[model samples]
Target: MDAIDEHIVSLLRSNGRASFSAIGREVGLSTNAAAVRVRRLESSGVITGYQAILGTDAPDGVAGLEAFIDVRLEPGRDSEEFLVWASGTRDVLDAVHVTGPYDYLLRVRVRGTAALDGFLRLLKREAGAAQTQTRLALRPSAAGASARERF
Candidate 1:
């Protein structure tokens, strides 16, 4: 990618919905040229599907008291089984299968402690004798922690 392509991507990263014409003007190109370039980038996999940045837009069927549950499953248990179980649970924001001492790291959000407790129980049962580590964030982590940063 050249300077113009980089500039276009930078702008789009900030706002994926930025108009082609607007980006074109920023990079000194016509609308059609900008569209072509963007399509080329997408086709080449340099530009993946455009997506909106979701802040606090939690998924459906779940609510409240979100926390990071660092989990360590029994050594012999199948990790994929744990992940598949997680995939079926809507309360899980996401899960990371990591190489640390902890077998799995989960980003969970629930209506409250009771829900969290229930979720933990499910995790323990599904993971086959797992140890849980939970953390509740009292407040949003410094809202926009990366709001001010250089690219």
Candidate 2:
């Protein structure tokens, strides 16, 4: 993408709801021009989709506790099984197959400690995770804010 396209992406990343006019104002393009560029970005798959970054108090907010669970699969167990389960499971925000001490890293969100405990229990029982190390996330920050501030 060109510089202007990159700028448009940056603005959208910070605020997906930004109007085309606002983007034009910031990037020195007319509203129509901005709209055309944005449409191109979308059609080209550069702009996949927009999403709201809900706060803790949102109705379906991620305001609860977040944890990164490093999972170790049982010997001879297939990692694909766990990956597929995680992909379809609610509350699992992300699951990444990593090369390290753990077989996979699961990013999970829950309402409280009790909920997290229950989720972990269910994970162990059903996911075929032989062992896991859970680390609680502290004061998660927004990626958009950081990028905006830097630029």
Candidate 3:
């Protein structure tokens, strides 16, 4: 992608609701030009559909315990089957297949340890999870530099 494309993506990443006119103001284009560029990006698969990031664990909008499950599978287990199960499972927020000792890494959220216990148990029964390791996210202190901010 070029500089203008990068700028558009960065703006949307921070706030998906930004309008064509708003984006144009930041990137030196008119609303019609901005709209055309965005449409082209979407057609070319650079800009996927916008989505809302809703609160899963918090009713008052404060994020709660974010955790990862390092999942090891039994010999000859079907990875696709496991992934399908993981994705549809209620408590699972995200699942990734990655290279390492573990076959999958599951991101999850729950109210507390008791809720996590129940979620893990279901995971074990479904996949016969050979060995599972876990890590809990404490908090994010830094917002970090963005793509636009980097340049």
* TM-score against native, each model: 0.53, 0.56, 0.52
Q: Candidate 3 at residue 45, lDDT? A: 96
Best by lDDT: 2
Flag regions of model 1 displaced more than 4 Å: 1-62, 141-151
RMSD of 1: 14.5
> How many angstroms is residue 24 displaced in model 1 relative to the true structure, after the best TM-score fit?
61
User: Which residue pairs in candidate 1 have backbone atoms (N, alpha carbon, C) closer than 3 angstroms, thus clashing?
Assistant: 64-110
lDDT winner between candidates 1 and 3: 3
Overall lDDT per candidate, in order of appearance? 0.79, 0.88, 0.82
lDDT of 1 by residue, 41-98 (tens): 8899999898533234453634467699888888788878888888888888789987
Native-referenced Cα lDDT, model 1:
0.79
Q: Candidate 3: worst 10 consecutive residues by lDDT?
A: 54-63
TM-score of 1: 0.53
lDDT tens per residue, model 2, 62-124? 577888999998888888889899998988989999998899999888877888999888888
Error of 3 at 53 (Å): 22
Off by over 4 Å in 3: 1-63, 141-151
C-alpha displacement of 72 in model 2, angstroms? 0.3
Query: In candidate 3, which residue pairs clash?
Result: none
Cα-lDDT of candidate 3: 0.82
